[model samples]
Target chain A: MSVLEISELTKSYPVPGGGEPRRVTVVDVPRFVVSAGEQVALEGPSGSGKTTLLHLIAGIVAPTSGRIVVAGHDMTALGEAARDKVRARHIGYVFQTFNLLQGCTALENVAMGMAFGTGVEAGRARELLERVGLADRADFLPRQLSSGQQQRVAVARALANRPALVLADEPTGNLDRRRAREALALMREVCAESGAALLLVSHDHDILSQFGRVETMAAINRAFATADGNSPVETR
Target chain B: MSRVPHHPVALLVRRSLRQHALSSAVTMAAVALAVGLVMSVFSIKDQARNAFTGGTMGFDAVLGARGSPLQLVLNAVFHLETSPGNIPWSLYEEIRRDPRVALAVPFALGDNYHGFRLVGTTEKLFADFEYRKGRRFEVEPGGRMFDPTRREAVVGSYAARRTGLRVGSTFQPFHGLFFDPDTQHEEEFTVVGVLKPTNSPSDRVIWIPIEGVYRMEGHVLRGSGEVYTPSPHEEIPDEHKEVSAVMLKLRSPAAGMALNQTVNRQGTVATLAWPIAQVMADLFERIGWAHRILTLVAYLVVAVAAGTILASITNTINERRREFAILRALGARRRTVFGTIVAEAAALAGLGSLAGYVVYLAIVATAAVIVRAQTGVVLDVLAWHPVLVAAPAGMTLLGALAGVLPAFKAYATDVASNLAPAS
Candidate 1:
């Protein structure tokens, strides 16, 4: 069964000031699908609309025109609140910066991943932390952990709610070469172990070489990879 | 899905309070201080009024030489203020014989022992009069009422405690209201009894027989000198006898009113203070501005404390935008984010309000001592009052109200942008 399916998804943003009245289309994906238990690497340089595509799939930002179904829920048709619920119940995201809550323990951060979903499942959080080789470090806060360890905790959090799909955007961007390889291996191995599909985006060729299946932004999205998606969007 | 916390917002708020312990404590302490002050002002004001009026517990009216009725009540009943001079002893006999009167106790004042008043009354005051409803003047187990014919006295409980004068103690009376070494009388009076604490102005007095006051060597009546001590065979003339004030308890409320009209309007000798509670309540009404000013100041402190809550939360909100964004990314709704901010404020105020009672107790305990010293009314610091419950609850509600501004700021937080690396 497919965990993620996107068809003719496009996101366009209007220019900053209203003078010439031009709109930039950041994401124009004709079709995309990731079956359960599949791990695919998406390769893209900076400002190539890779993050925008991930945002659309995650329902963090709405698509200008198209349908996105994640774990059988229609992401495009849902309101922001409903979309948030869908994302919480179906998708887990791992940002490059290890966005763990600074004030919470590793265990607490994992629990927070399940906060909006199943209330909180402490035993499951502990089990995931133990699986990530951070059982002894569950009480430690984010600042107390090393960069590799933080990413490990983030991976644990991503799989906390038993998500159907995991979207990792440059997950190993800050790690050294060996740590990056190890982090990627652990993330992909966990996704496979948990029967969740993994779609990881990275710019490094070395990182993409490890994946059995890989595709570049130009191949998936037909839009020009020019605008770095930091501005407001307007659907035309 | 946690260790039974039930909600992450509360858990997050608890952690945030610990993280910013200093600012949290400062804001909470401000809230606690305001709650304490507001509660204390209402408590002490109410207690003082009750004690002042309650001092007239068993008496129906006060009759003194023509003077301000308030002054007469204060002077005779409370041992406060100066005596409004003296009325003839015949007037006391006339009131005592009146059919409307049930009990009449005469007091002659004008002397002191170390600033404690010396009231001259018959032994009937200790044996028959009730200082409070159904509670008579109780002397210590080994003590007795002062001997009416001898130079003996009964020390009130507070006067005994303050001056260390117990039974068998002796002291010379001063000729004036204030204790003066030069004005000390040559005559010595024995302390034969010590009355128990009545928690009224009566507790601050030294009681002697009326004969001692009238025949005290230098006491002159109608310029008669009366220099020598009266013999057992020779009695003071009825025409020369005088009394300062008479405390009356009438048979009925109507009788009190009739006597008040007759003595105050028809006759010209004495003023009658009927309905003693009203006299005290009127006094509070006259000085009501002070109570209002205190209440206003307490409310102002609460407003300032609420401002601190606003400033404190707003300051932290700016730094924690990413934190909130992270929660949004974690799938927390905007309402959850809003609830978290409000809960933090309410938690601070609620915790502070709980601690406010401690502050209130400390303040009232300190004020109670001062009040008891100034006016012998023992304030019950631990007594329950409506303000006790209202102040803290109001503070917490106000705290939640204060959080609305910052909660809105948090609710409008841009998750997509704030989630971006702030570099």
Candidate 2:
């Protein structure tokens, strides 16, 4: 079963200047799917609508026209609040900078993921911290943790509610190469363990080499396909 | 019992408070100060009203030379203001001998030892006057009231403690309402006794025989040295003698009304003030504007405190946009985000109000000491009033109201832009 399904999805923001003839389309995905528990990589250069597509899939922004089904919830059919609920119960987001709340401990950051959805369970938060191998650092704030450790906490928090999908937008973009590799391995393993599909968006070629299956934005986004006229990239 | 888990808003609020500890503390301190001032004003007002209106200091009416009835009560009963003018001793005698009069204590005030007033009256005044309900003047152990015709003085409890005058301490009278070194009388009066604590205005006075005031050398009798007797201890004649005011306790309320009608409405010589508590109440009512201004100033402080919260939080919203957006991306609703800010304001105000009682106690305790020192009125510092409940609730509500504009600003933060990658 597909944890995420997208069809004919596109997003557009108005041109900065006020005019009737305006609105620049950023995302134009023809079709996409990520099966439950699968780990997929999306590779594209910066400003190529890679982030916009991810946001569309996460329902962070409404699609100008199309359907996005996150887990079992029809993202396009829901309001902003309902979309938030979908994001809470199904999709876990990991930002590039590992945006752990500055004041909260690693365990509290994990518990906070559950706070808006199910209620906070301290024992469960501790379990996630332990699973992420930060058991001894449960009480340490994000700043206290190393870059790799902060990413690891972000991974634990993403999987905190055991969501159906984890949307990671360059989760290791701020880390060293070794830390990035380790962070990638940890996120994939954790996503696999929790049976949550992973769609990791990154522009780095070396990072794309690690995934079993990878899809380039040049292929999936018809907006990019039409604009660049580039053939689909390699996929396995 | 199991401890309930904190809600997401509470969790966020708790963590944010820790994150912004300094700004939060400053805002709360401002609120505490405002709340403290407001509570103190209200407490003092209620206590003052109680002190002034609750007991008439055991008198039913005051008869003095024609003037403001309140002035008559002030000088005669409270030993406060100067008597309007001195009524003839003949008028005092007529009131004293009336069947309607249960007891008449005539006061003659013209001197002070330090700041405490010296009131010259008969020993019968101390023996019969009730300072509170069922409470009479009590002399300290091994002491007694002054002799009726001697220059001896009975020091009040507060006077004894303040002036360090005891049963045998002697001090010359300063012959005026205020103490003046140059106007000191030649005759020295010995402290024959000391009265126990009365917690009334009387506790701040020195008592001597009326005849002593009449014979104090500078006090001219009948506009000449009309010697009733060659000896200084002899009685001064009625035509020559004068009393500042007479505090009268009536046999019945009907007698008081009858006297009020005759002396106040019909007679021309003296002013009659009846139902002494009402007279005191009227005095408070006249000065009530000052109390209102104090209360208005307190509320203004509350407004400024609320404004501080608003400005502080609104300023924070600029820095916290990302955090709120991140919360939105985490599945927290807009109202949840809005409630986080509102709840923080209310929490700050609530904490301030709790601390405000500490501030209030400090203020009231200081006022209590000063009042006890000057007027012998004991203020109950820790006494609870309705404003204690209403003030905190009102301030917190005001705090919540203050947070609304900032909460709106926070609520409008777009999740997609704010939660996007920093790179």
Candidate 3:
């Protein structure tokens, strides 16, 4: 069964104009799917609607028209509140900036992931932090931790709920080469251990070869094709 | 995350406040100052009322020369002001013999010992007068009431302490209610006794025999201000005797209205004043306006403090837009984000009010002694009034209301745009 499935998905925004407003589509994907526990990487250059696609899949943003099924829930048919509940119960997200609550300790940040849906389990959050090799840094606030350590904490928080799928957007964007490699390896290990499918978005070419399956946004996002004709759609 | 099930919004609020420590402190201080001002007003008003009502408990009516009822009560009961005029000694005797009068204690004013008023009265005042219900005056240990024949005095404990007069101390009396060194009487009175503290205006008085005041040089009758000098063999005339006011206790509380009407109907020779009613009415009439104005100002301060909370939280929400967006992405509903912001504002208000109450208590505790010394009003900081509870509750509600704008802004935040790489 597919953990995430999208068909005919698109997102658009209206640009204010002196005359009539014009709508610009940002994400246009005909079909996309990730099998249960599958590790897929979506690579795209800047302004290719990569982040918009991730947001649409995670149910954070509603699509203009499409079917989006995450962990068997039809996100497209659900309201914003229900979609949030679905995300909390079955989907986890890791942002490019780590996005840890500034004053929250690492363990607390992880615990907060489960705060809305199932109620926070401190033991589970601590265990996840330990699994991410941050057992000694559980009490350290986001600002106190190094970039690599903060990313590790974010990964731990994403996996805190043991969701069916984890979406990471440029997880190692702020890290050094070695730290980025370490963060990527830690994310992969945790996702595999939790039996959650991984959908990672990044523009970094050096990290592409490490994933088993890689999909480029240009291949799927129809909105990117007409805007940048020199770029060719390709997937490997 | 330590095995405790904590609300995420609560954690977020705490974290947010900690992140902006200086702003939070300033907001809390503003709230504290407003609460303190409000609570102090409430406490002072309550204490003053208690002192006024409690001080007049011994007397039901004041009979004095035609004058303001309020001034009569103030002079006769609280010793707060000078008597307007003198009533004839025969009127005191008439009230004492009246069927409706339970007790009539004559007060002869126009004399001061040091700065304390020298109240000229009989020992019946000590034996019959009740300061509070069933609470009578008691002489301090090893002290006794003064003898009426000799120039002896019984001082209240407060007066003794304030004037540094002991049982063997002798002091010359000043000729008027206010002390004047040039008008000092040559006759000296010995302090033969000291009364225990009564927690009333009585505690600030020096009690001397009424006959002793009549015998003093320069003493005059009700209509005469002539200085009466007794020759070596001449007896003082009884018709020349006078008293400042007569404090009357009624046989029944219901008889007070009848006796008061009777005394006032007997022409302008003497007027009846109900001590409690007159003092309270005077107090509410005079101090009531100031209380209302102060209360309005205090409420305004609280409202402004709430506005401060609103401004502070709204400012924070604007800066924390991205942080909230990240939480929304983490599966928090918009209401959750909204609630977190509201909770932050409420927390600031709740903690600020709590701190404000503590500050109020500290101020009341520190001022209690001085307030009692000056106004004879005991300020009990532990006294529980409904306003104490209402003030904080109102402040917290105002704070939550203040959070409404900021919370709505947080709820309507654009998660996608805020989380975008460009943003």
**lDDT for each candidate structure:** 0.86, 0.84, 0.83
Worst lDDT window (10 residues) for model 3 chain A? A227-236
A69: Cα error in model 2, Å = 1.6
- Candidate 1 residue lDDT tens string, B1-423: 225255788779988998899999999999999999999999999988888876545788888889898998888887778888888778889999999999999998888898888999997787778878889998887888988888999998999999988899988898977778788888799999999888887888899999888767566554122323454447887777778888888899999889978998998878888878888889999999999999999999999999999899999999999899888877888899999999999988998898889899999999998877766678999888899999999999999999999999999998767766411
RMSD in Å for all candidates: 3.0, 3.5, 3.0
How many residue pairs clash in all the candidates, one count each?
Answer: 3, 0, 0
Computed on C-alpha atoms, the DockQ of candidate 3 is: 0.49
lDDT of 3 by residue, B1-423 (tens): 244338888788888899999989999988887887788889877776766765445787888889788888888777777788887767787889989899999888888877688889987898888877888888877778999877999998888998999889999999888778888999899988898877777878899998888777787554334545545345556556678888888888678778766777756688888756655667777878899998999989998899899989988887899888888888899999988888888888889999988888987887787765654556678888777888788888888888889999999999888885621
**TM-scores for the candidates:** 0.93, 0.93, 0.94
Question: Which of the two candidates, 1 or 2, achieves a greater lDDT against the reference?
Answer: 1
Q: After superposition, how far is residue B247 of candidate 1 from its true place, in Å?
A: 0.9
Ranking by DockQ: 3, 1, 2
Q: For candidate 1, lDDT tens digit of each residue in A26-124?
A: 788889998988999998766677777887888878889998999999999999999889888778889899899898889998888888877788888
Question: Per-model i-RMS in Å?
Answer: 4.2, 5.7, 4.6
Q: In angstroms, how far off is B347's CA in candidate 2?
A: 1.8
> How big is the positional error of residue B95 in model 3, measured in Å on the Cα after superposition?
1.6
